[model samples]
Target: MSPEPLQTGRRRRFQEWPNYRWAVLGLTMAGIASTSFPITVLSASLPVIADDLQTSESAVSWVQTAPLIAMAVGTPIAGKFGDLYGHRRLYLWGYALATGFTVLTGLSWNVGALVAMRTLGSFIGAATLPASMAIIMTVFARRERALALGYWSAVTALSPAIGVAFGGFMVDAFGWRTIFFIQAVPSLIALLAAIPLLPDTARKPEVRFDVAGAVSLGLAVTGLLMAINRGPEWGWGHPLVVAGLAVSPVALVVFAAVERQTADPLFPLEFLARRGFVIPNLVTFLGHMAYMGTLVVAPFMLERSFGITEVSRISAALIARPVGFSVGAWYAGRVESRLGGRAIMIVGALTMSVALAATGASILAGWLAGVIALLFVAGVGQGAIRTPAVAGVANSVDDADLGVATGSLQMIGHIGAATGITIMITVLGPSESSERFFAIFLLAAAIASASAFSARWSPGLGTARSAGAGRRSRW
Candidate 1:
């Protein structure tokens, strides 16, 4: 390239800036928070929205359900595209389209419109999950990525909690639609800034886009997630639910076949064979099962066992988990350099298991304080695993594959959380008794313990970083 073109490119990318990486991380997070907060914030206003739209709460609940299913199906595809095109390109397009949908969401006239807008917004916005991680991994050195990812994990854990707490207040004061309108402003700003400041990741244009694999995998995941999500409401015997359940495994088998034949697979089937790649994802899946299961049931436990029905008080009690999560992520990020990723993951998962088991005991004894404190510890445990787990998986893959790799990991985690929530709710099953709650929690605890044991096999990022210093570290 000529000198003038080089100068313009540098100006556009701002790579010359000493702290450009941090700037990218901040702007990326700002954009993410704008979109993500609404996911949990809407939960606080579901009843209000149902009444205003003249719809049943059951009908309006699709606002939450739809986005989740869309995200689960879209995450891997978005990541794959980023690997084939460019992370910055995917990020820019995704945020721009998502922002447009957010505006539409604010203007929704009915529950269906609201659900449609949020679902489309999240479907496109899912690109940001892997794109952001790829960008960070691209910008930072191997040894430095853990800390950057720690902050990322912290924000991911805290954004929803903040949404539920402060967002509820905002909804009461300004109305639900206003929240989306406010969200759009920051998202737009972030998009504008990202255009100039963010750098792109490597693209594999030589490799063919795996349309067949993407389609098969999308069908497989969508069917499974839809079945799991609706089985409780529609009944497992419902034809649609049974069809979803039946179609999913068949689709997955087809997906595996498609991936084997595809020259460039959407998610490389070979990665599944690697202990480093597979075990960390399994740990993530198991950990989320326990954490999310407990989270879904905690409010009910409080309401039934302690008569703690006040929204403000319940919100206050629940905030501890995310707060502790933030702390644990920060601490783990800092210490992963010394203690190593696998060890941190093991300890974190163990803490979650222990905290949850104790939480069950606390509930049985009517110790509300103990229950709240244990929940915080559980959050910390979950948070501690986030950075290391992600780092482990990211390092295991080639740089070209980071987006899909991390996206797959995230997808598994989301599925685990959904499965956990479903299982816990099923076990609790209209029962208000403390013993029933305790027993269900024990199951969650057992699930988390399984995760802890699984963590023992996680790839060691700390060791990999230490062993390889000058070149890109692949664990």
Candidate 2:
């Protein structure tokens, strides 16, 4: 379907600014934390979970793979659902489903049960990632959207950093299942918040659910995730891997066509094709690719090269990440009110490059402090780029398709981070040595800087100076 126009003017009925902003933003963070918590939680819990299930580490590793596979497939579909339905309602349901599965996950008796339950659970839970953004865009004005996106981005990104530092202790103290239990906090909190806090505003639904598009895209993403996830273990050239790799590309092409032709496609082709919407997604995808390198490999390097068992606590250095992200977001958010998304994105991209290179230098030197400081810088850049990036898309497009746009944004994240991590691991040699990782950071840094250049030519998404400000919004 065509892009829906955003609701203009002041908030109607009970959906006031400042009030709805905090609550919705809080819930967005909570939803993202709960949905994606297990990815890192399971990593921490692997020792206990493997022992309890009498499984090999290699066999149980699918816990991470399965969820990504599900989420990769589910994200866009869920995004479309949010657009078709109400994002607020869908957010609540996503939380509710996540809460139920999390509880069931803690009760599983064996690895098989655990894997199966989690597979189903991820499909339901991870939908919140995209849905939350859709709801936020639906509620906020164009000028306010960037800062809102900025704050939301900071909180969501901070979750894994928090998970890394704390997940280990939580597992050691409360057992691995506590990870699942802890996830319930967000679900319960968001569910409660939605009752009184979620704005009851609704869009005049326009996009029709494309069943064929759903199946094709779902199959393609699931197949691609499986191929990439298993490629590390199974060998990318394995017959099944070859088949998955071959199928996904074809399906992806078909999925693109479906969007282009369908009268009311599940995903709008214009947003994906447009510069404002597409450029930031591309740069952010690269940024996430760089982040994937840090997120997955940093601790491994520390553990192997430095022999640090208390790496979890050391990982707390990443707290600096949220610090940078928040600062970057606030600054860029303020600028997005007046300047434009393109300019802010360029700064964020530049920050990303510097941070990634510094990260490499620190890795080579084996200094944890340097690494942490670099991460903080990278995060700030990430924060600056994302707020305007998303606001660019949200402001450019009509509101009816806001859910689709937001979901597409997040889906790019999942697809890029998922594939990028796999690719980085493949290239980094798995040795955890500074030399082995040096290339990783260098390459990531290069990508960041290059993406910055690309952002300049990207299409404009348009921007609001600020809802409260008395100026024109830029794109």
Which predicted model would earn the best lDDT? 1
Candidate 1 per-residue lDDT, tens place, 160-182, comes to 78888778888889888888998
- TM-score winner: 1
Error of 1 at 198 (Å): 0.1
Give candidate 1's TM-score.
0.95
Clashing pairs counted in every model: 0, 11
Q: lDDT at 15 for candidate 2?
A: 61
Model 1's alpha-carbon lDDT is: 0.84
User: Global lDDT of each model?
Assistant: 0.84, 0.73
Q: Lowest summed lDDT over 10 consecutive residues: which window, candidate 1?
A: 466-475
Task: Candidate 2: list runs displaced more than 4 Å.
Answer: 1-13, 16-18, 34-39, 164-166, 201-207, 317-323, 430-433, 459-462, 465-475
